[model samples]
Target: MKKDFLLSSNDQLEKFAGIVNGDHPLKKVTPEEKIKVGVDLGTSSIVLTVLDSKNQIVYGAYEYDHAVQDGIVVNFMESVNILRRLKAKAEKVLGRELTTACGAIPPKTGEKSAKVVANVIEETGMMCTGIEDEPTAAAKFLRLSNGTVVDIGGGTTGISIFQNNKLIHVIDEATGGFHMTLVLGGRYKIKNDEAEKLKRNKEKEQEVYSVIKPVVEKMAAIVQNMGAEINDPVIVVGGATNFTEFTTTFSKVLKRKVYKPLYPQFVTPLGIAMFDE
Candidate 1:
């Protein structure tokens, strides 16, 4: 079965904005001829988000795959090919060419790796305006104020410590959805392909979580150890934390406030859009 592309509606986006921005009089920007786009090139998936000038979500879509690994563009042409398809589909839905977009990378990426991400966007015929770290991107989407942002993507966990709404420290480590997949695969005696499917199966959630609990706990410990002044609430984003019980599990282990947006996976993409000028 094909995955559902539209995870949340405009109404949900509004609610998400309210949560992140707090109760302020929101000024709606009239839809213009052109829309801004944000793309998240994740380890396990690629996400595209379109927003009006007012920063309202107009249309968005995401596709899942294991094409890229650990924030590295292992299959450069393949990644570009996937983005081309995604951009085409999104243009069809929005009735416009997504000629410009902002993209992101994991924290502490080398200049070459960062350029690779920009090149992928350029290959899609979209001019890349800005490229930022995944955690910084999440903080922008969440409109965070003086808090740590933890982005757990498919192959790595990125942590950013913020104070006074400024990034103070950034760190990345190999620990994420792929780790969960490994645990689930070993426990169920299934191959990685089958394990991925089971991970998304609502009916198998209980069984899947049981096997991945230890790994998630270990991830929480990693966050706690890395973040010294992260006593403030931690905002969790990225596809890895999409598990139903993820927040509860992490919260229990960390013993602190953990917040997740409505569609956690799209946080980085939305943040990328926010960075667009």
Candidate 2:
């Protein structure tokens, strides 16, 4: 793909992040307009995204919760409740009912994980339209036809390699933002919640990152060990890739330039919305 295409995709991600961040108002849509909804039951949070028929951003919201662990729904009812609240909130903002939606899970997590994700979506009263692998969903939003997608999510780092738009090799490992939090907690002697908060604090990011850098390096090692040919445009997405030195550190280990779109955290959630049809 052209470099310009990636630049534009980053622009789209920026716009979507702005909407999710409340920097932009909810998009106005006609009653006849069709909307797509995506439910992302992430380890750190559950995100709900809405897009128009043209795939333009409409609204997005997220709430932090431990309803899921390592891309699986460990607390089914809690996951359902969080998604239910997000749906209600979206409906109130969009002034219409969301009857259908899609979701995603980590690659190779199997049909059981997909079923649970579908169940969570259904329990929220929305028809589960589809379930996709997290890296593929991120790749879709990034418009990557031939490249690598490294999704460093809250609970796992998923790697997907594509050739001619076909996903050829994929892997998922249990080293992600949660692991970083644990590392930070160990180094700071803080609780998990406090470590998580500290990990995200802008002022403390450098300190937190220094403590968690090894974890990031380990995540890169996971990718390097995948044994598949890493292609160009190796894009990193998901909430775990939020740190300033994330891609830089990952690239150093992998010995390749990695691209990260704006608001990497929201990439998968927004991409999940693309499968809502």
Highest lDDT, which number? 2
The best candidate in terms of TM-score:
2
Model 2 per-residue lDDT tens digits across residues 51-104: 999888899999999988888889999999988888998888888999999999
> What TM-score does model 2 achieve against the real structure?
0.97
Give one digit per residue, the lDDT tens place, for model 1 in 202-254.
Answer: 89888888889888888788888874667466878887887788889889988
lDDT of 1: 0.78
Clash pairs for candidate 1: none
Question: How far is each candidate from the true structure, as Cα RMSD in Å?
Answer: 6.7, 1.3
| TM-score of every prediction relative to native | 0.87, 0.97
List where candidate 2 sits over 4 angstroms from the true fold: 1-5
